[model samples]
Target: MNAIIENIDVLLSGFLTTLGLSALAGFTSFFGGLILAGFAISNNPTLRKISMLYVALMQNIPAAAHLFFMIFILPVLGLKAPFFVLAIIGVTIYFSAYYCQAVRSGVNAIGRGQLEASRALGLKNMQTMRLVVLPQGLRNSVPPLINTTIALIKVTAIAGVFGVTELFGTMLQLINVNDSAVIALMLVTGIGYSLITIPAALAAAAVERKVAFNS
Candidate 1:
């Protein structure tokens, strides 16, 4: 208790780092995943093939392996990024593959007639995606998108392994120093993460139901 009170600033700083990483990864994955979905559904066979390969490669690569490559291999090739930035970039690429699949399914669920209608209305392909297809597909994808957001928050723990002082990293250090406070620290971290993830999941569920009814 004394240590925790004394280290409140350290713990709060760590928590903020974790939250920022989560938000960065979440927003990038949403937009990047949408772009990947667009590629996957493109009329160009070459673009679709490339998108398929990208998703497959990202999905098959272990997260640790991906992290190691980004932090290790990329630097050797002269592309050095800060730890937090690298972690966010790597996780966004990894998780966005899954989101691509989810969003692709949502896009497919919308009938071809929607695209045809957009085309008939003089909307270009980009305009159709921006104004017609993606909006409806995203509304349909809200549930899965929410699930992915929760998953991304938990996945930010991976940053700890890279020496990023996120909440988990901070907790690990504190527990190691105090030994007896391990359980308490862990409980706090878990509760903190849950506070972020649970509401996101619930909100997604509500939006999904509402979208379904309006469809």
Candidate 2:
């Protein structure tokens, strides 16, 4: 307890970094996934194939491998950035694949009747998708999207491997200095993660309820 109190500043800084990384990665992945989902559902065969290939690749690769590639291989190709930036990019891309699938499932859940109704109302394909399909699909996708967001937040700990100094990194540094504090530090770290994920989960549940009621 005293150890945590003494190192509150360090813990807080690390928590803030974790929060920022999760937020940046979460929003970027959400929008990117939407675009990918659009591609997956497009009438154009080439676009569908490209989206399928991307999903296959990202889903098969591990997140740590993605980070390692970003940290090591990208530099060999003359692409370099700060560890924080690289971590963001890695986490975003890693989670976006799952997000794409989640959104795609939601889009698929919409029945043919909805599409036919839109077409009968003189809406073009693009307009029908934009004004009708995507809105409901996104709503239906909230639970899975929230699950992905929670998982991504936890995965931010992997950023420490590349020297990004997020919450897990801070805990590791603290543990090295005071080995006796390991249990306490880990407990605090779990609490910090809970602070973010629990609220997000609650909010998602509320949104899901509202969506169901409206539907």
Candidate 3:
């Protein structure tokens, strides 16, 4: 018990580290995904084709391989980022691919007539997308985005394997240093994540329900 207390600061530090990385990556993925979805739905066939290939490449690649490539290949290009940064970049790229698809579906779900009406009212493509289509699409997209955020949180554990000292990394250290208490340490890590994530999930579900009723 005293050892657990002694390690409390380390655990808290690890939890915060994971939280920060998850939040940064989540934001990056959200915006990157939005841009990719826009490109996918653009009028130009060439742009759409490029976007399709981008999604296909990312979706087909295994995430572990992607991370390895990011860590190894990026350094070769003179970008020697820290492990946590690389982790965020890796997960952001992966999550953005899926997010783009989800948001694209939401964009498509909007009726063509509405777009035509906006154009008839002298709205440019940019104006129509910014002021009308995207707003509605975002409402439809949020629930899935929240779910993806939770999944990203879970996936950030993979950062530990790269020597990023997030929650799981610290847990790994603790388990290795004190093998007799592995189960307890794992439970501590699990509970730490649950404390942060459960509320976000519940709030997202509530918002989704509200959007459904309003829609």
What TM-score would you give candidate 2 relative to the actual structure? Answer: 0.92
Instruction: List model 2 lDDT by residue over 1-215, tens digit each.
Output: 88899999999999999999989989998888988888898989999999999999997899999899889889999998998999889887888899999898877778788889999999998999899998888888887788889889999999876788889889988989989889999999999999999998898888777767332
- Find the number of clashing residue pairs for candidate 3: 0
Question: Tens digits of per-residue lDDT for model 3 on 107-132?
Answer: 76777887888999999989998888
Q: Give me the displacement of residue 175 in model 3, in angstroms.
A: 0.4
lDDT of 3 at 43: 83
- Give the local distance difference test score of model 3: 0.85
Q: State the TM-score for model 1.
A: 0.86
* Model 2 alpha-carbon miss at residue 20, Å: 0.8
Q: What is the TM-score of each candidate against the true structure?
A: 0.86, 0.92, 0.88
Q: Model 2, residue 191: displacement in angstroms?
A: 0.1
Q: Write the per-residue lDDT of candidate 1 for residues 114-205, one digit (tens) a residue.
A: 88999998999889988988888877877887888888889888788787899888988898898877777888888878888889888988
